[model samples]
Target: MKSPIRIILLILGFIMLLSEGFMGLPFLGGTYILSLGWAPLGSNITMYFVMFLITILDRSNESRSSLSTIAAVDIFANMIAFIPFVGMFLHWLMFFLMLVYIGIVLNTREYRGNTTHYDRHRAGETVREYK
Candidate 1:
């Protein structure tokens, strides 16, 4: 993924993390919207489903693939959520979570070489090369 996209994903992740905390606050409109019956349940179900999708995506690649797949999934899911009855809020939330997941995947460290080390002093400065 490009650096700019990764940075944007990180920013979105931070926003989602914040929103996740306030999801229960009555002052935040979602709480009221959630109280109106089926929407809340539907939103919860959608969130879990999307989370599962993200997990599957994560497991499919050992390294960050590209921004294309992530962007496609996000945009497609958001479009599906736009249906008036289904509401796009939950889909947006999942999109944000996926952004976070992608950011995490991008930031993870990958070992490029052997990490084990042996002390030269203990071996009296003898130099040995292992192939």
Candidate 2:
């Protein structure tokens, strides 16, 4: 994946992390959304659908196979996120997992060989010989 796209995903992950905290606030105040209705479950399912779409898109970028795998796992994690305690822990775990995945993506280079003339010169190769 491109650097800009990876950065955008990192930003989105942070936003989701923040939203996760906010979602817990009601629970602390004794206002359970789960008790109110099935809205929370419905929203979680909707989010899973959206994440599935993202996973499909990520899969199209052949260079980032690991990213697609991580995204796919994230979809399943979110699917079970409506469960009382397990769901909450999974959400937090997935957020951190995503951060790690983004770090890996950012650190990876698409082309490992040196492309600059200076690098070739330092390697004792004639710069003019490069195509």
Candidate 3:
């Protein structure tokens, strides 16, 4: 992805992380926010948008990031977020998981530093002769 776009996404992810983490607390009325109301639906849609944006904007051939995978799981959790106590705990857990995933996503590089021997062979380059 372009550097500017990547930075934008990283920023957006952090914002979402903060919003969910703080608002998810019971004292802050997180339960109500994640309840059977429209919040979960909005979050689910945001998750889908983020997943698709990352997958599409990211031109790298590497496999999808853990965030995408966790987002998939979050969908299920959101479904059950209608539950009373369980939903609150799940939201907190999801925040922690998102923290780890965002770290991984931020640290990942778009390109490998060097090509492997297999790449040389595939390109029909001469290999060093062995005795």
Model 3 has an lDDT value of: 0.62
Tell me the whole-model lDDT of each prediction, alpha carbons only: 0.48, 0.56, 0.62
> Candidate 3 residues 6-80, lDDT tens each?
576567667757755765678554545635465754665476467545755566625455556766666667677
Q: Put down candidate 2 lDDT per residue, 1-131, tens digits, no spaces.
A: 44555566556556555545544453541245467553654554455355445535763344455665666676677667667677667756766666766566567554334455555445765669656
Clashes of each: 0, 0, 0
Task: Highest TM-score: give the candidate number.
Answer: 3
Q: What's the TM-score of each model vs. the native?
A: 0.34, 0.54, 0.64
Best prediction by lDDT = 3
What lDDT is reached at residue 6 by model 1?
Answer: 42
Superposed by TM-score, candidate 1 places the C-alpha of residue 18 at a distance from the truth, in angstroms, of 5.2
Ranking by TM-score: 3, 2, 1
lDDT of 1 by residue, 6-120 (tens): 4554565455445433443434445444456435434544544444344345433344444334544544444454344344454456546555565665765543345678777
